[model samples]
Target chain A: MRAAYRPGPDAGVTVSDDGMSVYVARLPGGPLLVLDGAAALIWAEATTAPATGWVARVAELVGQPEDAITADVRAFVADLSARELLVPLGGDADPPTRA
Target chain B: MATQEATGAPSAGATVPLEVRIGFAHASVQWIADRCGADLLHVKGAALDPTLVPGRGYSDADVLARPAHVRRLLDELPRHGWELINTFVYGSSFEHSATLRHQDFGLLDLHRIYPGTGPTPERAFDTLWSQRTTKVLGGIDCPVPSHDAQAVVLLLHAARGGSDAKAANDVEWLWTSADDAARDRVLDWVGRLDAGLAFSVITGTLDEHRDDPAYDLWRVAARGGTRMEEWRARVRAARGLRAKLTVASRSVLVNVEHLTIVRGRPVSRAEIVAEFFGRPARGLREQVSRLARRSRR
Candidate 1:
């Protein structure tokens, strides 16, 4: 089964000066960046209105295919986790219950 | 008119041996700079947005040692100070610690470039070096990276320290401060790293600045995975908790706290310490226990 991307509690963020700071944080140790500004568009779409499968919906936001959003979401979450920014959701192991 | 200066002064020259950086940990840098006398003529790091002032802001302390004195300065000063901390891979030579109580009081980073570079890649440093300007620092000739390089370098450094460091929040100012051309030039520089795992990490960072009308660099960072628009909400949330942050100890139970006033409300320092470890304040209990122990002693 394909891993369905689930959005966590981490807030959507946007850098004003753009994505020059792609993966790395603002200065020393911070969050990851796509540098393509994908985080910006998704941040807007997902912020005010909460949704399920928010990651896969990114493509729709950027005028790309839904598959593209899913792919990018996987990559973004993977990168964020590697940098210690996002905590793992522990898929399949734990059943999802509405918080 | 003739005048006489006060005789009591801080010691000159480095107080400890120089240590090399394994990756980006700065604690080693601070430990050594303390013992070594840091004249602190000029400290550079992060960006110099037209609105941003040099020599101000919540800055990470950096110190410069004369090239001629570099070898000798790093060689001596081990006995005077005890070990404060060391990184995962501390270069045998570079040892960081805090020694002085003025200016760079809390954590001092010893470096050839004090608080130098924005959080930029090595290539960014090369770009900075390419356009370096020679300046006399502490009575010696020194070449400093251009403001553009400085800005990028500061951002990269902030990225390395994670969300815990104060200077990292300077990204909030970058969009609100720098011009489009300057911001675009930086995005172009970072665009070079778009096709790797590193690019994916740029998402959260890019989202932080998605709304700037000034430049589209966030678009560049979005290519990795996350788009700038996706981060708008997080940016708003981050702005709420940005300033008041701290990583108090290096122990396994790392203490994180927010220390600044956000939106006119101050972040309670004690609450922050507790929040850092997911528990309520135990400081008062600990304080009482310590007092009891002292009474018995």
Candidate 2:
């Protein structure tokens, strides 16, 4: 699954070693934070799925209530998107820092 | 590989040093304050830190403002010739400047709110913000915050960032500079605000890493050195465990005080280092020897 990681300047998306989880940091603050294990798994799927209905897909895999999982996934993307961390796959946003 | 030699843990027996990086920092900040036309407050422990490290306290400078002025300062960064770094999420909010380097004087820090910012039981702003309590530096008049205020902030900075040897000196200066009444006021304020949290952290460091060479460095007076690997480990571990908690816990606090009361004898750097690493470096060889269970992850 795709997730954005800013190791230095540019943001790149890649599947995590664990394969299930993804890590993302937004701007306004360069390094927001880190989360591991299951949460990372969900995050990776949401950021990378390349479909409008990825939220529903994520719910099925994580084995949680569908509506709750969908809402949470949406909220996570909204935050990263608001912080300008992620773009809508093909489109871009504000000036990316040096990267 | 971590040792007292690398971390530059201040020796406990050396009385105090005469110069500190904080001195230049203070000077540079003062330069900024005068330029901004903001009222400057006397930062108590910075002067005393020099006594311990010979040149450490020179790096500190502080000023107080009504909460509203901070917004104006942020908006005017470009005009003032400073770049706005991230607004700090802990203690009181402050900004960082990438440009204010003084020639060998020290880095300057301009503060808006004192960490844990509040007047203590024995002090009010009037007493500390007095006209007479200032040291004339580049020729501008400034008021000093009470010693108690300075001490408390120092402790929080050490706990917040954990590498400020400067803050540790401020803890020691509670005894060196202020009277017993002021010290009690600081301790009382600390207890009132977050005794459980502070005690948990301070004692946690003390219990786990007190015997490492880093701890030993502060126990004896010796010239200090940088322990980059050890420092990095502490930063990584502290961030791993406390990173999320740091922003959330400090969300509601008023201005951050950057100093604290210097109580009795100072805790050793080895202790601070050990606490940061979650174990004493000195005993790692032995601890590694006792791999009773080869549990694989």
Candidate 3:
């Protein structure tokens, strides 16, 4: 299984004024993805800490139940991976499930 | 950390960061202008308000000065090591502005009037100067156009350049960042400049109009001329046999300096001549077809 997920090499991230995470690609006139507060926290943590426990950590930080957010987190990660905003570690695998 | 190169020398292959070079250029130009008692208004590029669009990259610095002060600055700039590269005179107010080069600074475009094709350059300059705001750049007080004025200039520039991406981005930034009052002010300036057509196209306001006479005027404006005005310009451009020949020759030969800048290197005269004649022809056929279609209407 993959150890973690990380932002793509071309992804340039900046924090918006309202605490959203804005991700821009290296290419000129590329798409801009603005991640909301909850997703921003997840991305902030995922970029630094291991992705293994990010689900529980994000759930705790957002004051949501781990089960309540499990599907949404997985979906968000999958969508990001599909868009090359997030890349899985150790090649490819299913989106990480809550540890 | 980059030391300024010898005054008036060419950078050639220097590795100085662009932003650092721009800062140096702004400071150097400001210092020299102050010494000559010339007021300099920094426009475009790094002069953009960072709070609206941060981390924007700029290749050159553009500054506007009074027409009378331009000659004095031009004569004195070389003494301080700024090399005068070119002076292109398109018309009275439609000049190319001066292109200056320095070893420490990358490229500087000094204008006596705003370069965009819009309302009269003198009027634009007076309005912008009246509303100019001072911003400190590289420890030098630089005058910048107000947001409303900047928006109008950027829109006109984008329209003239066939809607370039960077120009569009800057205009969009200004549009989104402006408050209702600022937006209204920009619209008023656009109308005054006869750039309402360009503005409508840029902001997609044209889409809401249906067979409107105003829309027709905007379309004509977007093309940079109406049919009668274009014909008059052609007549003016070909006033005499020598002028006609000059225009004809220019159509086939690229200016060596222009070729050099476009190619990003020193180009030989022969290369320029070859590129001029060998360059792909423009869409003259398509243009004629469009003209014919318009005539039929």
Candidate 4:
């Protein structure tokens, strides 16, 4: 099972009301990052729960086969994790309860 | 800190929106204040509760720090890319807020006092802080004055806003058309904050406060005044012999920081000398014209 993700402790995130863009910044200072297009789609799915098939959800949103986009999505998530803007929840940590 | 600029954009050439930048500015300051253990209330601009006036636009972020915490916040702001462009003493007639600029977040006004409030800053902060609530800005839960207190603060801002269309519009929506209960709540805050002197401008009872020390300050602010009148009013409003002297002295000095911004670079000493001499002549011209107009009337 893949680890779920959540915004990092210092991350300040705002998704536009239209859901077309996600603005993220590191607090105490910033170089604000705007994520849109496929990046926005990936962020939306990665932070939502049932982390099991999160990459597949991204693929579904972009209307591409899961296998084709899986490697790229992982790379993007890793980049965000390295920047400390997103954190991978431990396997034992509770998946956010769905509404 | 993950605050470093991203070297690559996921999508090419996507510029951050102005409001988004402002939101990040709020988040940046809140983070700084938290680290410094300072108390601040995000007010006006982006922090304002949107329901108060729908579609009201704002260009920058404004935050009010507890009076005692202001110096500490100022000391810490620069470490986070918040450059102090204008100190409070030169900020305005009230000397209330310092202007800071950030590389990614545009402009911010860090207020030590929310002009028109107070018999004193400490008491005024306590009154507002006691009823504070939180609002999310830049995805961080930020403290803000309560709904009713916000109404009072907004009205006070409009009261000194002179003939600014936006200020008048704020008054029309937040005061003129507000129901009696809303008015009562705002009045209660005004009394608690001891903001009656300035609030009188909104009530159109400004002439009644002629004897007040700060009366000319508010009068000049609300009705507009020539540069000479403004300095005279500032001198009159300053509390003590020392403070009045300070205001009077500053009225004659050139603001180097403002000059730098206007010129978009560090100014030369020669330029400073030129402006120093030029300002008094300009102030005198304005004063003379105003006097002539008054006599003609």
lDDT by residue for model 2 (B19-106), tens: 2223333433444455566445545445332333344434334444434444554444334334433244422222211222232222
Tell me the lDDT of model 3 at A70. Answer: 73
User: Per-residue lDDT for B154-246 in model 1, tens only?
Assistant: 554344333433444555554336688867865654554222122222335444544542113223222311222222222332223431121
**TM for chain B in all models?**
0.37, 0.42, 0.68, 0.95
Ranking of predictions according to TM-score: 4, 3, 2, 1
Q: Note the DockQ of each predicted structure.
A: 0.01, 0.01, 0.01, 0.43
TM-score for chain A, candidates 1 onward in order:
0.46, 0.56, 0.75, 0.86
When summed lDDT is taken over every stretch of 10 residues in candidate 2 chain A, the lowest stretch is A90-99
Tens digit of per-residue lDDT, candidate 2, span A1-99: 433322222222223455642333221112322334555655555455344455555667777666665545555555555555455553221112221
Best by lDDT: 4
- lDDT by residue for model 4 (A1-99), tens: 554789999999989988878888988687677787788877888888777777767778899987777667767777888879899886522223223
Task: For candidate 2, give the lDDT of residue A45.
Answer: 55
Model 3: lDDT of residue B164: 59
Which one wins by lDDT: 1 or 2? Answer: 2
What interface RMSD do all candidates show, one decimal each? 21.6, 17.6, 17.7, 5.1
Docking class of 3: incorrect
For model 4, the superposed segments whose C-alpha errors exceed 4 Å read A1-3, A92-99, B1-14
Model 3, A1-99: lDDT tens per residue? 334676675444444445554332321112334455677776665554454666777789889887788778777777777767677774323334556
How does model 2 fare in lDDT?
Answer: 0.39
Compared with the true structure, all predictions reach lDDT values of: 0.35, 0.39, 0.61, 0.86
Of candidates 3 and 1, the better by DockQ? 3
| Predicted model with the maximum TM-score | 4
Enumerate residue pairs that collide in model 3.
B8-B81, B9-B103
